[model samples]
Target: MRKALRLTALAGLFMASFAQAATPIDVYRDPNCGCCKSWIKYLEANGFSVNDHVEPNMSALKQRLGVAPRLPPCHTAVIGGKFVEGHVPVAQIRELEKHPELRGIAVPGMPAGSPGMEMGQAAQAYQVIGLTQDGTDEVLASYPASSTQ
Candidate 1:
């Protein structure tokens, strides 16, 4: 019984360390964008280690990253070699990391109530779009507007 308990404790420790081993994300955003900062804070609060890069030329960076032109762009993030554009939520970001078939994901425009774009009692419906390996846009998830008046 003691040996079994010791092995269980060891397994728990290993699991804890693995959980903390998430890849650090590099976020590039305009220096003057407040929403980007808020998004970074949200990520940090959700247990992500964020490396914030205050970019000077956002359009050029977005272009270089191959962000879809149809997808409304804002701050850009790279995690595990996948581009995360706009205000993607933490859940979708995790899903993106797990899907090797997707090139990237985006929340498109800064819809209200998404992560950092929160507006008190006002939320706009939005879709989380995934850029597939073939460069096609796929709706990965959709969020409804807040019902709170």
Candidate 2:
């Protein structure tokens, strides 16, 4: 009985530490949007701990977070002290984690095949934009015609 109890306690400690090791991502989105929920699920599935915030004024939230007014998406997230706007891919998210110098990353506008915006055969080519806190922007990654996700 004592051996079983020790093993159970050890397992609990391992689970707790594993959870703590996950990066925490805070997502803000409109309450009425279904795509936002899908995006949150995508993040969670990719090993991110998500904190969802149902926001009524999305534009205001974007403005305060340093996301350009021109770049708009169904949802926005704050991860690793940087802003992530739109349906950014898991690979790109991992890239940002590896390089914390970037101020933010974004996929402006909703394109089908993206994590939340996906539908059947309607995906469009899009670029993942990297932005500095100063408002300067560049294409960090691009999804071609064949793969929009």
Candidate 3:
């Protein structure tokens, strides 16, 4: 009985870990950006299944998707009905999953220390902004910038 119980607990633990892995995220980015690739790698390392699409005209894509210019970034993603921009933290993405009403999230410009943008030792200060369907935005979280500048 003891051995059976231990096996059951172990199985449960494994299942829990699997469930916590990041979900599928469709990321659209410019083909020439190195930071964008790094960001994709970050998501993959954290369990996110990414379907990456490289486009030369990211501006047109953004415009069609209703993304605000002020919140633009090196990449864009659509996951669980929320649009994600830039090197957004995996934790924030998970949090957004809980709020189904949000239209999306944006990190704006490529600030240092943001996932793939990390450089140097000092982190830059940046904000993660959430947008609604109509284009209004709200500050969701603030993170330290990349060390490189």
Candidate 4:
């Protein structure tokens, strides 16, 4: 009986972790951009399933996707009806997933130390900005860029 309980507990733990996992994101980026590829790899390594779309006309795509000009980045992603722009952290993406009402999230420019943009121990201060369909935005969180201690 004890062994059965232990096995059931283990199974439960495994299922819980799996259920909490983040869903894959479909990313659209410029084919020639190395930074965008790096960001995709970062997402994949951190357990995000990436669907990459390499387009020659990234600007046109961005505009069509309704990603604001002020929040342009190296890449853009859409998942569960939410748009993710720039080098946004996986954790923030997960947070956005929980809030179904949000239109999208953006990091604006590529800040040094943001995931694939890491540069030594120095990190840039950047904001994860949230947006609405009407073009309103608000700061979700301010993340410091840093890859090393």
Candidate 5:
């Protein structure tokens, strides 16, 4: 009976940790885009459960999601009912969790060194922009181009 109780407690903790880490997200991307797949892997590693929606018409999908044309990226995601575009870092997602007032966030273009766009030792200056419901945006985070970037 003691063993059973211990197992049950372990199971409960496991489920809670999984829930806390995983933020369910539906990703929209082109089936042929390798970078997009890499980005998905980044999210999974960061504890997000991603559902891929591979479609040839990426533009249409973005349009349907009300993604601003100003912030264009190879992929987009719906998470916690908020839009997440491009290779946003896991850390930024944590920030988003804090700012429930914002609608979503995006990294305009796929900059090198950003999660999936990583190239050999090259990181470009990039900004993670936050979007409001009315389509206004602000820079939530900025990353400098660095050797470690």
Candidate 6:
């Protein structure tokens, strides 16, 4: 009975730790951007602990982070030292962890119906672009438009 009780306690502890686990991400956004705040709330809901930073000059910040001037940058985020630009979904963000060869991943522009940019089920088709270590862009994931729209 004591051995069984010990096993159960250990299992419970493991599950507890797993449940409390959260990925830490630092988000930099312009103070005037309302959508960025919505994105932060979405991240928190998806088990990410956000370290929010309001930057006055987002252009300089994005440039310093290696984000290309061509990409539509609403906000910039760092996850495990990799840049995540624009409104990237949580699933693709998790996939980024598996590919160390990628310098970072981005959604480019704010697409309607993305996590924070939801517009009553009107989701626009978008692709998650990944910047490789070799400095080439690749499509990592594609989100289709919602049929309900």
Where in model 6 is the C-alpha error above 4 Å? 1-20, 147-149
Question: Candidate 5: lDDT of 34?
Answer: 94
Please provide, for model 2 over 1-149, each residue's C-alpha lDDT reduced to its tens digit, 9 standing for 90 to 100: 99999999999999899898877889999999998999998888878899999999999888888888777777899888888999899888878876555688999988887877777775788889888756788788989756424
Residue clash pairs of candidate 4: 123-145
**Model 2, CA-based lDDT:** 0.85
Candidate 6 residue-wise lDDT, 60-142, digit = tens: 98778787776756989998878899989999988888999997889978899887898676689999999888888999999
**Alpha carbon lDDT at 40, candidate 4:** 91
Q: Candidate 3: where are CA atoms >4 Å away? A: 1-22, 145-149
| TM-score between candidate 5 and the true structure | 0.82
Per-residue lDDT tens digits of candidate 5, residues 87-107? 889888777877776788899
Q: Model 4, range 6-122, lDDT digits (tens) per residue?
A: 999999999788756846789998878898989999998888878899888878978887888888878899888788999898888889977655789999888888878875767
- Candidate 1's residue-wise lDDT over 1-149, tens digit each? 99999999999999799668755899999989999999999998887889999999988887887888887468999998889999999999988867888989999878988999885857899999999889988899999987665
Query: What TM-score would each prediction reach against the true structure?
Result: 0.83, 0.82, 0.80, 0.79, 0.82, 0.84
Better of 4 and 6 by lDDT: 6
lDDT of model 1, residue 9: 100
The Cα error of candidate 3 at residue 27, in Å, is 0.8
Pairs of residues at least 3 apart in sequence or in different chains that clash in candidate 2: none
Candidate 4 vs candidate 6, TM-score winner: 6
Clashing pairs in 5: none
Residue-level lDDT of model 3, residues 3-48, one tens digit each, is 9999999999997888676489999988899998999999998989
In candidate 5, position 92 carries an lDDT of 88
Residue pairs in clash, model 3: 112-146, 113-146, 119-148, 122-147, 123-145, 124-144, 124-145, 124-146, 125-145
- The lDDT for every candidate, in the order shown, is 0.88, 0.85, 0.85, 0.84, 0.86, 0.87
